[model samples]
Target: MTYRIEVDQEICVSSGRCVAEYPERFRFDDEEVAEGVPGAPPLPDDATLRLARACPSGALLVFDAQSGDEIDIFGT
Candidate 1:
């Protein structure tokens, strides 16, 4: 299943990791916080998880697209 990714600006550190790694999917807002690009193609589940885990500030969040349930990347 496809996954949805979001950036929590409140938690975002503006490291630019997501913007650099996935320019088509993410971009920095006026305040320099990372945000997901609207209408961007969805990422696969594995890649989505990897992206969430790679966020240094834990700003990236992953969700089950169909279920709208948040995925706990750090959970067992």
Candidate 2:
């Protein structure tokens, strides 16, 4: 199943890691906070999880597209 990705701007530290790694999926807003690109193709589940986990500030959020449920990236 495809996953939807989002950025929690309040939690973002402006690290730019997401933007640098996935330019097509993420970009910096006027406030310099990271945000997901609209209309961008979603990444595979594994890759999406990896991207969220890679965020230094844990600002990247992942959701199950079909269910609209948020994934617990840090949960075991």
Candidate 3:
């Protein structure tokens, strides 16, 4: 199960909640602002959802690369 996380940079508000809560999967650079952690491996189910939930704009998106299905962490 290959997993990947992506964010809509245009919609991001730079609140930094996601980075603060899940630094393992997120980073806050002063110039670049907050972004998904680069070069990180696929995350366990729970950790993935935690990072999603921490996102304020729901800008974070998770998907199964093989299935091409959105990882419905919010069940929305």
Best prediction by TM-score: 1
Whole-model lDDT per candidate: 0.89, 0.88, 0.75
Query: Which of 2 and 3 is the better model by lDDT?
Result: 2
lDDT of 3 by residue, 1-76 (tens): 6667777777778888777776787786666567777786667767777777777888788888788798887774
Considering only N, C-alpha and C atoms within 3 Å, which residue pairs clash in candidate 3? none
- What order do candidates take by TM-score, descending? 1, 2, 3
lDDT of 1 at 55: 93
The whole-model C-alpha lDDT of candidate 1 against the native structure comes to 0.89
Global lDDT for candidate 3? 0.75
Please, what are the lDDT tens digits per residue for candidate 2 over residues 1-76? 6788889899999999989998998999999999889899988788888989999998998888999999898772
**lDDT order of candidates, top first:** 1, 2, 3
Model 2 clashing residue pairs (backbone): none
What local lDDT score does residue 73 receive in model 3, on the 0 to 100 scale? 72
Question: Which whole-number lDDT from 0 to 100 does residue 49 have in model 3?
Answer: 74
Per-residue error (Å), model 2, residue 7: 0.4
